[model samples]
Target: MTVTVRDFRPADAEAWVRVRRAALPYMVTTPGQVLYDLARAHPGRRYRLLVAEEDGEVTGTAQVGLSHDSPVPGQGFCNVYTDPERLGRGAGSLLVARAEEYLAEAGARSVYTWVPDEPADRAFAVKRGYEPRRPAHFLHLDLANGTLPPLRDAPPEVELRSAADFADDPRPLFEADAEATADEPSDTPAELADYDDWLATTWHRPGFDRALTSVVLVDGEVAAFSAATTDGLTRYGTAMTGTRRAFRGRGLAKLAKNDSLHRARAAGYTDAYTGNDAGNDPMLAVNTWFGYTVCATEVRHVRTLV
Candidate 1:
């Protein structure tokens, strides 16, 4: 049977997550998260989730969208993933073709994607005109067996708090996220200009564990944070970890991440995962110090549309 690419449907949520998990186990996501994200996506983003189905089974998925929050305009993205067991079934090609067409229609002048570091995957992107850009590492920590570093007491000037503590007001977290995100290394630099959008997408995102997300305060101000997400079962992941510019050298980011990781282990999460750009030395060092090992790598690929 021929593989068919179509817009994601409500019924495909479970299968979509399954295919994504099979293709990229390091990235944590769930069926509810997929549905919630689709429902709450910003209209300006032109976000469209595509699924490639073969014989009524989802074999691949693609997240196609315009970079609405990017500093550069006319930029788009299409990250495609196919189940390892379903390779060579043409699902990947169909998904990418459809995604490109959608992106072009949405007025994108260039598209970016992350291709797995494997030779076959790199060849697939190169054949489609994507030129390699930057590389990123996917790190994993064996939370069940590996030992985490001892949690150190925070300095008298630093206070540790969970994201849940800011239930009445999350603007402080947003401000810190924006500041840290500005300094992140990436091919497509993003700026979180709209607080409402941030609240809708990040703060209210499904599976975001506010109780496990640790924040560091310096002199009563939000200085660093480690946002966490979980499968509500045995898996835990760090969504983002960063420190404000003024607090960069104080080790506050490490403090927050350590607190969050310790909380996750105590909560019965057996596995933890995170990704880091090759250019981000500080973060890579932090993850390394936490006993995380690089499990996979992916190269960012970009193609200019004429």
Candidate 2:
């Protein structure tokens, strides 16, 4: 069967999510997310969602875009995934080739991609001229069966709140998120400077569950938080968990995340997923303490497109 790659149509949302969930089960995705992403994608980013179809059946998908938030220019990413059951059919190769061409035409000097750590996956990327870089792992917690740490009472100087409390005003949450995200480990560093952009992209993301997101306040100031994104179903993913600079060493990260997990279980979410760079020991220990085990690993790879 011949494989063809083309721009994503609204009709392909369901199939796109199906292919992605099959390839990356730990990541939460839904048809709403697929449409929302394409609708709200920034023009500067030149984002494109491409899919490979064989005999009218979607066999692969790729999210190709520039890292518009990064300070450095010409940074691009192509996250490609093929249906596990439909391998060796040239879907992945065609998708990668088309995505790379799109990035090059968009003036990207370098393109990065995530390839699973498995031997064949790594070999596929290396053969396509991608050089391995940092490694990251997805951790899963069986929320319905796993035991979460007992929620601790906040001290007199500290308080815990849900992100929904700031529905009328989310700038503080954005500030806290920006501060925490600045120190995140990544191949392309992001600078979250524009509040309006963050509002449209991060805060308004379709799956964002403000009520399930937990925030820790030190004397009424945002100190740490665990942002959450959920599929309207049973899957829950920790979007980001971090403590501000001054709030470090107080265990606020663990406290906030635990509170979120406990609430998630109560809300009927059965699976919890989070990702961390392999070298981030502090966050890894925190996840381990919560009974999250590594479920998948993906290595970051980069190729010069100039």
Candidate 3:
């Protein structure tokens, strides 16, 4: 069967999510989120969701777009995934070709992608002129079988709250996110300076589980947070866990994460997942202490578009 690549359509939502979940189980995705992503994307992003079909069945998917949130211009991304059982087909190459073409036409000077930390995957990226940059791990915790640590009580003057508590005004949470994100380790650093953009893209995202997203407040100020996402069923994922600079050594991050995880378990989520840059030893240690084990690794690869 020949593989063909084309732009994603509304009808492809289910298949797209299925293929993505099958290939990258650690990540959370839903049809509604996928459609929302495409519809709400910034024009500067030039985002395109592409699917590879084999004999009319969707076999692979790619998210191609420029990094609009990054201060750097001419930076693009094309993260592709294929159904594990359907590898070795031409779908991946076709997807890459089209994605790179689109990005180059969109004025991108370089493209970045995440390649699984396997010999074959690394070789494929290298063969395509992409060089390895940073490594990241996908950590998993079995909410049903694995034991989670007990949630600790917040210290005096500090309180644990749900993100939903800030529904009236999420500006504090947004401020915390911007500060934490600026300090995060990433190849394509982001600057969340625009609150309106954050509301539209991050806070209002369909996957964001505000009820389960734990926030730590000290003296009524955001100190730390663990943003959570769920599949609306059995899977839970920590989209981001960060402590404000002033609260870094206070163990507030772990506190927020534990609260989120404990509530997630009570809410009937069976699995939890998160990812951290390999260089981020602090977060890695925190995740390990929470019983999360590294399930997979992906290497960031970049290629200059000449």
What is the TM-score (0 to 1) of candidate 2? 0.99
Once superposed on the true structure, which residue ranges of model 3 sit more than 4 Å away at CA? none
lDDT string for model 1 (1-102, tens) is: 889988999999999999989999999999999999999998889999999988988899999999999989999999999989999989888888898998
State the lDDT at 191 in candidate 2. Answer: 86
The lDDT for every candidate, in the order shown, is 0.94, 0.94, 0.95
For residues 1-306, what per-residue lDDT tens digits would candidate 2 score against the true structure?
A: 799999999999999989998999989998998898889988889999999999999989999999999999999999999999998999999999999999999999999999999999999999999999999999999999888889888889999999999999999899989998899988898989889888888889999999999999999999999999999789999999989998899999999999999999999999999999998999999999999999999999999985
Q: Give the distance in Å from residue 285's predicted Cα in candidate 3 to where it truly belongs.
A: 0.4
The TM-score obtained by model 1 is: 0.99
Clashing pairs in 2: none
Candidate 3 structure quality by residue, lDDT tens digits, 221-303: 89999999988999899999999998889999999999999999999999999999999999999999999999999999999
| TM per candidate | 0.99, 0.99, 0.99
Q: Provide the RMSD of all predictions against the true structure, rounded to 1 decimal.
A: 0.7, 0.7, 0.8
